[model samples]
Target chain A: MNNVVLKCQSLKKTYKKKNRKLVILKDINYEFKSGHVYAIVGKSGAGKTTLINILGLLKKQDSGKIFILNNDVSKINENKASEIRNKNIGFVFQSFYLDPLLTTEENIKLPMLLNNSLDKIKINERVKKLLKEVELEDRETHFPKELSGGEQQRVAIARALANNPDIILADEPTGSLDPENEENILNILKSLAKKGKCIIIVTHSKTVREYADIVLELKKGILEEVSRD
Target chain B: MKNYLILILKRIIRDFKSRLVILLIALILLLGTIVSINEKTTEEMLSKETYSKYHNRLYQLVKKESYETKKKDIKGIPHIITILHEYNIASEYLSSEEFKTPNTDHTIQAYTADNLSLPKIKYGTNFPDKQGFYMVCPINMYPNSNLSSNNINFKITNKDRIDMQQYLNKTIQFQFENVNNMNIKKESIDIKIVGLYEVNKHSLEDNTCYINESAKKYIYDTLNNDLPSYIEKSNPEAAVIIIDDIKNLEEVESELSKIGYRLDPYTIIDPNFLIETKKINKTYSLILSIICVFLLFLILFKDTKNTLKYNKLLKYLGAKDNHLYLTNLIHNILIILLAFILSLILSFIYRGLLNIIIYFRPFLFSKNEIIFSITYLFKIFITIFISTIIISILNNVYIKYKLNKN
Candidate 1:
């Protein structure tokens, strides 16, 4: 698509266990576009998360190219990767990895802090705005444990949105939630998608697949288009 | 930046609180060990400091055991580097008197009051440049003062020095009686008064006189009050040697041994004293080192895991490796600064508490100890800096590697 946010080509990864090579991703290719929800579906250990992490620039691909926002990310140094990630890409893990010691407000402000691009006043203003967007303005003072599952996931979503990144990569975003929390988190992801932001979610849920604009299934270390909704 | 610092600080506060007891105990014990050891070393240094002040750069050559078999010749202090001379025989001022009957000479037969070993002249000039006939009237001192051998000899105090100041540039007749080997002979000499030395220079009632070679003809022994000092009354039985510097003591000793000259216990300065003092400090420092090393490992290992999550979180937030490294550097530096300050405070506290017990035999710090302390503190700071950098780099690399692996 013309609005492509991330594209991967011939990506591969492997590990050695007792001198035997175990390949994870083999010559995988994919394109992620803006203004759509893309769901990656696969069984456990099917390399769905691996593809997502490689796409997120969290891990290196063995022999291929990754381009984020039309620039080749593979040859970029660590500083550039961090810069692109902070400025353009956000992450939401299935565990809703909020800092346990921090309040919801602080959790949401963490990405912005790491990015180090925003001033305190701006970050504070942005944090307030994100809390309102996630409908957690009144819960800003509550720590992660004090929040419900749905509330924690919503906080994570707000954290992802803190830097207003161009893309959101959520790995099994609804994997650990109850049906209600799952539905709530799915709606949030779908809302972000509707707002013309790219949302990449790795999930095993049919409900998540139903809501996605595109679905890709991983098998034997490769991606195949399962459907286009 | 502000937000990042606040977050890092918040994490540190939380972690520190969680491990407050262990951290505090470890820090206090670690710093206390260094400080306690420093305090001990300081005291030891100060104790030797006074004695080392006059002797730090002094190296002496004693008569060889082999020479004692010959016993035919005595080599007294040489005039080339000679500041003062020692006379085994006692002398008496036949007439003039300031303090009273006295003997100030310790086993240290005599020393020339050079600018190095002797204090500034409070009254007259030094003895005459030529060896004809000159005398330096020592201040008559009470015997028990620290300058004399414990309590047996005479000593001159500040007051005696003031009284003796008038005797400067005044001639006095001295009677030297030789009673060696039961042979009795006497010589009377009218010595020119050249100068009066600082009275406090030798508070000991050392009946030592600075005389020229022309006056050496009268170094005879007296009958009544000559304490049985170790110096032989005759010359050629003992020789005085001066070392250029204390650091060269080893070389000088080796050289002197080749010439068959042993270390003279009779000399006030002994290189062995300085060596012994260093050995003591080294022993304590080794103990300190063991404790510090143990603490260093405990701190590093304990902190490695605890900081991993924070490190990962920062990295995830798009912190460059340098930023992370810098942050870790500052964090470790803060801890080290705290520990160092705590060590200094602990040292003073320990000193204050322990100094009372050591007050009786008060030892003052010497120039060498002062210089050593400065160098030692510099070394401590360099160590802290190096350790902080190393720990930060190693820990950051390790955490990054582990996180990447996972």
Candidate 2:
């Protein structure tokens, strides 16, 4: 039997605008196991982002049970939610949201800095290893502005791995990159998945879905599992 | 705890670097506020000290009639020793012939024979030893009505002596009589200027001439000795009593009142000085505290709100809320502390500037030895610290509510 890393049941998200309730997600049930890259594919406004936000604990689901490693997340408070996000989950954004003021190395070291549990030497060692792993060792001292789209995204990837999280959540990680940079990022994501990290990528690209171990489509507040070669 | 502190510090450094201009502006504002507050406080303290010293040295006393029953004996009552003694006293009369220039307008204070001892002189002389000797003038007499220095000419029996040397060997005419019945022409006599003496500066009467003991005796003896034999005897108009200590003045006054003597209005010279000083100090402190609190609250609230908004973004970037809060607090506290330190330095600089001004113009201060006293600095620190802490906590509460709502 496969080890379950994350499970979501009856997750619902409703948005209220001008006193009108618009249901973005309804009764969404999903299960994520270890060592598999899951891709949630959908067009814009299809609630892919909403689902990703809920899974990352950035937003609360209206009515749901979310269990991470057999711990129910809905019962936890904000601080515990943050703790779970900090220790077990990593996020990569479509905008390559690197802290613009920090150098690439500092950006990569941000998670450890925030956690503050790791000493400077351990942080430095982890950052160095991640920088080498992303093939951006020489670009560590450069800021986000100085780096290209692919290089910045690579720095973002290195930052996500800084805390050695068990789950990686990427929201359209390659949506801003060029064709060549997209392939590079996809290959990196694939490699990360091979290292036993449960990588979940939210994307509409067929290329990302091809690289993912499982592809799920969100259509009209419903989740449908699709097979990907 | 160590880890948390380190995390907070790192985040503070990052945010500071990110918003360098805002941080710099905050620093300048903080420094300016601190410096202004500290300088103002120091100036107030100096003024209080100046006023206190002068008030203490002056030893002014005022007499006010509390009841009609105590009115008759007011002047003779030694209220400084006991409240009851006020009944034996009479009123003090101060009048000026001309109100303008010192030379034209001469001030004359006429009191009973007993009231003469109230003014303790420091230098020059009081009345002469022999009968009908010389008139003693006030020292520190300036052209202005206000007494500035002890410099005055002596006029003995309508003969003006510009300098004291000329009057040393001369004999002068003197007269002493009741204010109501002054038969000065009939009883006037001549006495040699035996010696000179000085009076205390704190006395109520500035310019005074002492009547010789023998001279006063002669006036009383001549008046009383002839009164019963040839004319009607006159009652003693008033008497003056000087107490050893001013603290028991009220008790002495009350005691005198119990003896069927009407008590007069009296003044306590000692505590009045302290009371005036306390009033001035309280006003100064209150004004400064209000200003400091106003400025500090404005700065702290604005800065904290902006910081909290930034911290929310940090929280979204995987930082814990606690981490963000701590970073915001540390950064703000550090800026405030820096501003306080700079302000303290500025206060000393202000003191130095005041000293320089006083040095060039020595008359600005009554005393030539004006030193920068650190006694008020500790007061400033305590005031600023308390004000800043209160403002910071208020700001924190406001920011927390704002961010948490979002």
Candidate 3:
């Protein structure tokens, strides 16, 4: 039996520019399942980021149905979307948007704190494990600015995984890293998938595409299966 | 929940030192408004109390023509009495004449004043009943004794006041005609001596018996010499006036003019205490209000500009729009609440300093206070609400514009 965690069907989005319309996403159908890594590779303006935003419930599709674990959430209100985003979805960004004032461990612990689901003792345990998993246990007390770009990205990844969501959405996760840090980040994403969590990465990097269980190309407002690794 | 409160408190302490200067500006401005409101209210109340307490300094005099015409036509103390009484201005009446009481060769000054505007009693009750129609004799109504100050100094050896207390509840007859000793028909009436009052510097009288207006006709008859006058017995010898307030002096004078008194160019005695105090209180109160509102607005403007940076990062994290909104509402409310508390402390300190100085210069402030009325409470809530909304929107919009620009 196939377990689908997130899927979008016939997704469409449009932007209005003065008197004209610009179509961003059209006739896109995809399914992301458990325990797999899907890499969406595209050029700079290929609607990859827009699709990831739609799938994460941060933005609404103009015309389509999005199913997350059997629930149609294409047109959910902002409050309901916030609840689902906080409880079930985690995001990792290229720029490593950690609060500059908070320490590394505090950054990792922020999602759970906002969610208010786990106790202090449990959150502490989760923070330590995430710190060790991302290879930043020694730097847990350091602030975001004190770390290198790769270390900031690792803290961002750990924050994304803090609430133990079933799926992780990464937008250019390795785009700003050195080759060594990029490889280390990929190994972390791959390890998460192996541990039965679905990972979706939107990137322009060929190394990320090679590491994916499935690779898809987004071009001309459509997504197509390009290869299987 | 507790953790959230702890975080909020930690954020407060962490931010307090850096924000203290602007916070003090906001606090002082807000407190100016509060203390000004108190000062204005208390001053107004104090003025009104002073007006009511010493209103008898005002007097209304009638023209001789108006008095004579009304006496011939209305058969009473002229139409002005009824008119003044109807308008609630003449709360009580005062008339005085020298009269000899019953079978005794003793004369005493007599007047008419109702319970409301009567003289204060030193020993006995003040106008024992609301409609008490009796006489109050001074204790010094006897031979060679001028006990005007209540401590009896008798030029004669017989210092007693003919034992006036023994005559309580006893009838006293008077020849109720005009005192001018004319051949008018005698109209007699019975009066009872009921109470006695003290003599003081500001006391109404020392050697008079006070009665109500029901006895006014008999005293006026005495002016026609032991007989009832054919026309209304001339105008009252004097009328004691009490005004509602110093502010109402113009209205009272106008109303008196309408009742046929010579008020064409009425000379109004300017109430010195009320005028000066009102000027000082009103000027300071208005200045405080203006300074407070301006400083409070500017402080909020500056604070919103400064804090927008931190809030944007929280919004970027998993915080919803409402999350950021609530954070701002709580944050601004907390600051204003602190300012409000400090304002209260500042007002108390002001009162304390005023009290310290009051002993040396007594007229600086009165005992009237600025109590928290429902209206004031409502104003506080409204000011807080409106200010919070402005600060919240300013912070959110400016941050968004700056971020988008970058």
Candidate 4:
């Protein structure tokens, strides 16, 4: 029996706007096993980001049962959710979302820094290794402003891997990068998946879907498995 | 815990590195120091002024006089001393030199029996023996002069001129002749110059003197021994008394009046004067405190508003509510600590400057040393701490509500 790292049963979220309830996610049932790369694809307002936010424990569903590592997450408080997110999940934003004040190395080490589970020496060693792995060891001291789009996203990738999270949630990770930079980020995500990390990418890019073992589509608040090739 | 604190500290240091926050912190520190030091110094000045005024107004010796016979009534007299003994009252004998001098004409010169050992002596000691010895005079003769000169000239008889310098160690013949042809004589008196005393400059009374109790008794004896019946029936002219409670001087006067001694109703010193002055000082201190608190509140309000804005931005950076609150608290605490230390140094410097002013201009401090009073500093600290906590809590609650609402 394979270990399922995360599962969602009948997850639903709604937003009230101008006296109308707009359903963002509806009856979404999904199971993510360890060591698999999944891609969620949709157009604008298809609720892909909302699904990813719920999966990353950054947002609360109106009604849902979310199980992370066999623990019910929907009943957890914000602090506990944040702790679980910090320990088990990592996020990559479309804009890189690197703290502009910190350097690339500091940005990459932020998760571990916030968690305070690792010493400075270990953090530095891990950051150095990540910098080397991302092919940007020379750019460790460079701030986010000093790095290119590709380099910043690579730093974000390194930050996502800082805590050795069970799952990586990439929300349009390559949306702001050029074609060449896009390939660079895609290859990094694929490489992380090859290392037995579950990679979930929410993106509009068909190229991102090509890298995933399973491609899921979110349409009108309904999630459907489109292809498993 | 240590690692968490270190991380928080690092983040705070980074936040403080911002030029705006750094400048605000510096300004808060500088302003707090100036206000604290000024408040402390002002409180000290006010306290000293009030205390000095109170001390001067309260402490004094009063002597009341009236004749033993021809009973009269006195009531509601201010600051009077009543005597119970009738024979102890002695006559005022003017020396020949003092009688001839125009400067001593209007001066009310009185000689006491030196029974009451008052702390502040106003020039010239009591006569050594109770014999015919007489000291020159008290400072009340020349109340304005603080000079220490002992030389005084006096006339002994209508045809005789004697200087006190010549009679210092010799036996002198003195006579007391009343209007009824009765004469009292004394011989072989040695006069010596003892210690001199100066009255407080704030004293309102004129020239006064103290003679030996024996000398006073001798003069009284001489006047009463050979005097005629009519002269003996008349009032003694000068009387002296010791009072128990200085505060109930009016009651003493009424008590004396019941026994036939009439006192002139004149206020020696205003009793409520010191209390009124202290009330004024307290009012000024209260006003100053209110102004300080108002200005402090204004500064704190503005600081808290800016800090709340920064906290909002920090929250978006993945900081929890506690982290945001602690960061702001640490920042303010650092500024307050720095300001306190700097203010202490400034107060020391101010005290030194005051010392310099006092040294060259001794009259400025009224001969008192200048010292930095920290009583007001404690008040300021408590005020600031209370105000800071209140403002911080209000700001936190407001910001948290606004953010959640958003």
Per-residue CA lDDT of model 3 for A58-137, tens digit only, reads 66789989888889988788767767777677889998887665679877877777677688899899999999998998
DockQ of each: 0.41, 0.19, 0.19, 0.10
Q: What ordering of candidates by TM-score runs from best to worst?
A: 1, 4, 3, 2
Measured on C-alpha atoms, candidate 1 has an lDDT of 0.63
Minimal lDDT window, size 10, model 4 chain B = B147-156
Point out where model 1 deviates above 4 Å. Answer: A1-3, A7-42, A60-67, A72-79, A98-159, A174-196, A204-229, B1-49, B52-83, B88-116, B120-252, B267-274, B280-312, B320-345, B356-406
Positional deviation of residue A150's Cα in model 1 after best superposition, in angstroms: 6.1
**What range of 10 consecutive residues in model 2 chain B has the weakest lDDT sum?**
B51-60
Model 3, residue B209: distance off in Å is 18
Alpha-carbon local distance difference test for all models:
0.63, 0.60, 0.63, 0.59
Across residues B1-406, which tens digit of lDDT does each residue of candidate 1 receive?
Answer: 7666666656555554434633553454444344445544554453443333333333334564432432322233222233223342222333233333344222112233443334345567665555466666555423221343444223244443324555566665554445667886664557676765544322233444445444543343224326442234444344444443345556655655665666553445444655675676666545554555456556765877756776676666667778877887776665655555555555545444444344322233312222224344445445555755776677778877887777
Top model number, DockQ: 1
Cα displacement (angstroms), candidate 3, residue B276, comes to 9.9
Off by over 4 Å in 3: A14-23, A62-64, A75-79, A95-163, A173-191, A204-217, A224-229, B1-45, B48-52, B55-114, B118-124, B127-237, B243-254, B260-342, B345-406
Better of 1 and 4 by lDDT: 1
Interface RMSD of 2: 3.6
